[model samples]
Structures are given as structure tokens and as C-alpha cells.
Target: MLTAERKRKLLEVLQSEGKILASELSRRFGVSEDTVRRDLRELDRAGFLQRVHGGALPRTPTSVEHKARQKESTDAKKRIGAAAAQLLRQGQLVALDAGTTPLAVLDRLAPDLSLTIVTHSLPAATVLAEHPRIEVVVIGGRLFKSARAGVGVATVDAYRLLRPDLCILGAAGLHPEAGVTTFDSEEAEVKRAMIAHAARVAVVVASEKLGTVAPHLITPAGRLTHLITDSAAADDLLAPYREMGVEVVAV
Candidate 1:
């Protein structure tokens, strides 16, 4: 298995079992004890686990924090962000979806560009607040505390009034057959509104989210005009999206 897949599986095992012995993991995965220990240490640094003497234990359960999630794939997100930012034009109105990848796009936005940005993401709004040239409009609605973004009917109503030039859609999953899906139903509604209101839709996804499907369906594969991802995405996995006429931009 690839290292990323192995590490993700290791984390899943630790989460499911509460604790995992290094020796057991080494034996199960056919890897050395030293390799298991190294993996445990890396997971510890990522705040996913606590390394014990010869094993690892699950970290304390806590609500997912938006800022913490944004820091997870900093480099890959930056590349995706830069690529998304390049798609923007001066004086165009755009809608940015909530999530770490889109927030990265907000970070890379040029301060001197004249544009209007509409978003329900608090982090995205906060980042764009620093820019003097960009007009940042925060969609007011009931806040989803875990995501630190607005959702529900009020946010959906706000989106109906403004038709944007582009919308940067975030994804929990982007399967070839399943299309785009999210973890929450309300978030899915919000994404659907974003898709409907924008003239063109661009999905900002990390490599890991490529094949994974969540419970909530947002839009079909054909709705997206562009797919922006990192270089870590597989060619075979991206082929379906390309076949559907979606321009895949791997950063």
C-alpha cells in the first residue's frame, strides 16, 4: 500500500481499537517495529494519536475545529489555492465555498484586485477582510458551529439574489459515479445553491477526497466546469471527470 493509505489505515485502526500495540501493527502490516514506531510518532505530531512506550492511543475526542482542519494539508492546499486564484479575474464577482481548500484560495487572493467575494465561511470572510480592494460579503444565517459556516434557509435565500461569475465548490467526496457529496445534508443544500447561482463551478479537492463518498449528495459530475486538485491525485481516478468534459487542473 502507499504510505498515505497505510498511515490512514493505521489511524483508523487506532481510532477503532482505542489503542494499538506497535508489535501488533508491525506483524499485521508486515512492517518492522521501527517503522510502526515512526508512523505512531508522525500521527502523534498530527494530533491524531498519543504515542505510548511501544504503541499509540487515540487522542481525546473533541469537535472538529475549522482552523485545525485548515492546517492539515498546508502545502497541497497552497498549490490548489494558487491555481484557483489564477482563475479569478479583476472586477468579477465570485462565491467561495466553505472548507480548508477554499480558505487556502482566499489566502492566495491578490489584495490589489478589484472584485466582490461572497461566502458563508467565517474563515474565508476573515481572510478576505484584510484585503482593501476586494468587497467581502458574508451571508448571514444560522451558523454550523462545527464547520464555522452559515447554512439553513437564510443562507440559501441570500444566494438566490446574487448570481456570481464563478463559485469555488468544496467537496467531501468526488467519486466518478457518485459525483460530489458532503458530510452534512444542510451543507449539501448550501453547496447546491452555490452551484445554481454561479455561472461556472470549480471544485477544489485534495487528492485524498477523490474517491471517498459521504452521505449527502450536492451536485452531479456534469455540473462542474473545472476540477482543481493537487499532483498527488491519480490519473486513472481523474479520467472519469475528464471524460465528462470537466477540465482537470492538477497543481
Candidate 2:
């Protein structure tokens, strides 16, 4: 078959399968593994798929800046955020992670709800401060402009100091295999600290991020106590998490 036609068929297979292995593609397309690798490399360079260790997975938009991502995911964020709020308890010390979806939790909280919240996200702290009954603890560090969050040693260290009753985590990617991932190493460190110190951790993410893998990992998917997402995510997309013993809440 022609190279162009083979590449087209490769993408079609990738779309339907959600992942691709070079050896399998080589067998299917009647090409050598090296040719399959080259095709995947070109496709990765074109921003169509993200190359992984042995194959490629769908690319996630977690690299997009916080503001631009806000322009997307309108209703899904609201529904997921509201469902996350239901998981909260009064007078709890909450660790809020940095991301649009995690930050959305503040919007759904009752005005009179009493809680203490800690965060490394400048944007998240800004919103939590508006709640008079909620005490806000800001973790200081270098600002990560893309996600409007703080990153660095201080942010990681502060999270180690206290055990939050619950943590509202966020992810750039949430694959059943790759687990909870983000785009930045420092951000992953900060999130890891939160996971280690929180009594229970809940991730609030959009449906589109399911089955996708990001570059850096915060924790394995099994580490999460709760996986909350929009109902647009299919049952099959969420079954692995449930099998991992996580409480899956699809809003």
C-alpha cells in the first residue's frame, strides 16, 4: 500500500482503538516496524498523537493555558464541580489542587459552608478567599503561568506539613494505565505531596481526558479515593477505575 494511504489507515485505527503499537500496525499494514515508527514519529510531530514508550495515545490539551481551557468545557466543568462539592463535609480541611476543574469546586460550594482550604494555585486561592467561613492557606512558590498555579520546593514542602481531610485533585490526563498525569514535573511533585498528605483524594476532570496519557505522572490511578467526571464519559471508559476500587462518580 502507498505510504500516504497507510498513514491514513493508521490514524483511523488509532481513533477506533485509542492506542497503537508499532508491531501490531506493522503486521496489519504489511510494513516493517521501522516504517511504522517513522509514520508515528511524523504523526507525533504534526500534533496528531503523542508518542509513548511502545506506541502512541491520543494527545490531551492539558498543555493549553488555564484561561484558554476555561473557554472550553463549559457545562461539564459545572456538573463535575457540583458533584465534587457533594463529597465535601462541613468544617473540613481541604487541599485544593491547581486546575480549572479543581478550582470550579469553589463555585458550587454553599456560601455558608465552613471549611479550611490550602492551595498552591493563585487562581484557586483567589476564589476560596471569597468564602468568609473558609480559611485559606496559600502555598508560596514560583508561579506556573500556564496553569495559574505555584510550583517549586516551597509548594511541595507545605503540603507535607498538614494532613488535609480531603483533597480535590485535578489531572491533565487520566488513563487507566498511565494514571493521573500532568504536563509539568514540578506540578506533578506538588500534586504527589498532596496525595501523600491528604486522607482521601478526589480528581475532578473532564470526560475528554479519559483514556489519554500526559507526560508526567502524579500518582497511579489506583491511588485515587474518588474519580469524578462528567457523564459524557462512557461506562467502559470508567470501568478500570472502578475495578481499581475507586469510587467513580459520573455527574
Candidate 1 regions off by >4 Å? 1-65
Question: What digit string (tens of lDDT, one per residue) describes model 2 on residues 75-134?
Answer: 999999999999888889999998889888889898888888898889888888778788
Prediction 2 global C-alpha lDDT = 0.88
Q: Candidate 2: give the clashing pairs.
A: none
- TM of each candidate vs. truth: 0.74, 0.95
- Candidate 1 Cα deviation (angstroms), residue 18: 27
Candidate 1: give the clashing pairs: none
Candidate 1 Cα deviation (angstroms), residue 114: 0.4
TM-score of 1: 0.74
- Give the alpha carbon lDDT tens digit for every residue of 1-251 in model 1: 67788799898886566467999988899999998898888877887765656786544322246767766767988999999999899989999999888888977777688999999999888888889899989998999987899999999988878889999998877767667877689989998988896888999988877765555689988899999999998898799899999999999
Given candidate 2, what's the lDDT at residue 213?
75
